[model samples]
Target: MKLSEIKEILATAEGVNFKLENGISVPAHFHVTEVGIITRDFIDCGGTVRHEKVANLQLWDADDHEHRLKAGKLLHIISLSEKVLGMEDLEIEVEYQAETIGKYDLGFDGENFLLLTKKTACLAMDNCGIPAEKQKVEMVNLASASTCTPGGGCC
Candidate 1:
């Protein structure tokens, strides 16, 4: 999900809820500790330079169990972050602590925002010499007694 889309969704939502891909929900009292734009500029293994930017929302569970982040409040915080940090309509990456800090891709499932698990991918599969998947074929026994022998002209 993009920052603009979340802002639009927040306009109509009453509560801000985040769920993990595993159906586990982030604690209701979780705090969005930081909202900022993250820029990554690096070289891929394929020897190509790449640049990426994402809107990052860092979620933290605090001791204050009574705290709740309302949709409007989150929207306001997003707007402030945008105004102050010059954020763009980039894809949102959420950082939440599970057993450890995990980064997730943001998504919406009509009712709630989902933190989709992120996986590592190779950017240079072609250059890395990784073998392509081989096609499989079933073998049929054509050497049956009814079949012509190889010495026959039918070979």
Candidate 2:
């Protein structure tokens, strides 16, 4: 979700909670270690120049189990980051380390903020010469008895 959207959601939530797309919850004691704007500039395989910017929130499961980030506190931190770093209202990307560090897109259900699983996508599918997936057909459901027999000339 966008930065503005989260701000509104935070206003109503009791605390900051990040729910993973797999139905796992990032514990309330988790610390938002970093909040900064990330700007990535690169050239796609299609020879197109691209730039991306997002507000990043890095969550770390800290040793202090009593720490629970409240919505208001997070909002204040965000504001401070904005003022100090000149950050803008960009989409939020969360970085969390489970088995390893993974970047995710941010979202929220009615009751919980969500960390969506990120996947690699071809930046230029058309230029890569990868064919589109073919439509699936169920062989068992088709009437193919005539074509199966050796004497069925229709084959």
Candidate 3:
């Protein structure tokens, strides 16, 4: 989700909640420890130059179970980051602890914000040497369906 999109959602949301794609909820006591822009600039394997930027929000699961990050409070944090860091309406990437620190793409499913797993893809597939995946074709027996006979004109 874009920065603007979350801002709008937070405007009316009663409370802030987050869940993994698997439906496990992030601790309600979780804290948003950091909010800022992350940028990547590099050349792909195809030698094409590229750049990317996203708003990063790091969630920390603190032991302080008494604390809850309210929707308005989170919104304020985002706004402050925008004001100070000149952050644009970039897509949000969330960092949370999952065995190790894992990054996720942010999404909302009506009530709880969802953490979508990020996947790597070859941006330069056409330029890379990797072979295209072959299409799967199911084999069918034709002997039983064939109308042709040794001496028949149907052949």
Q: Which candidate is the best by lDDT?
A: 3
lDDT of 3 at 96: 98
| lDDT of candidates 1 onward, in order | 0.92, 0.88, 0.95
Stretches of candidate 1 off by over 4 Å are 136-155
- Tens digit of per-residue lDDT, candidate 1, span 1-155: 89999999999997889999989998999999999999999988989899999999999999989999999999999999999998889999999998899999999999989999999988988888888779999776676755677777776
Q: Per-residue lDDT for 1-155 in model 2, tens only?
A: 88889889888888777888888999879998999999999988888899999999999998899998899999888889989999888999999998999999998888888899888888988887888889998677335655466666656
lDDT of 1: 0.92
Which ten-residue region of model 2 has the weakest summed lDDT? 141-150
Clashes of each: 0, 0, 0
On the 0 to 100 scale, the lDDT of residue 103 in model 1 is 96
Candidates sorted on lDDT, descending:
3, 1, 2
Candidate 3 Cα misplacement greater than 4 A, ranges = 137-155
Alpha carbon lDDT of residue 142, candidate 2? 38
Each candidate structure's TM-score, on Cα atoms with residue i matched to residue i, is 0.86, 0.84, 0.90
**Per-residue lDDT of candidate 3, residues 1-155 (tens digit):** 99999999999999999999999999999999999999999999999999999999999999999999999999999999999999999999999999999999999988999999999999999999999999999786666657775667876
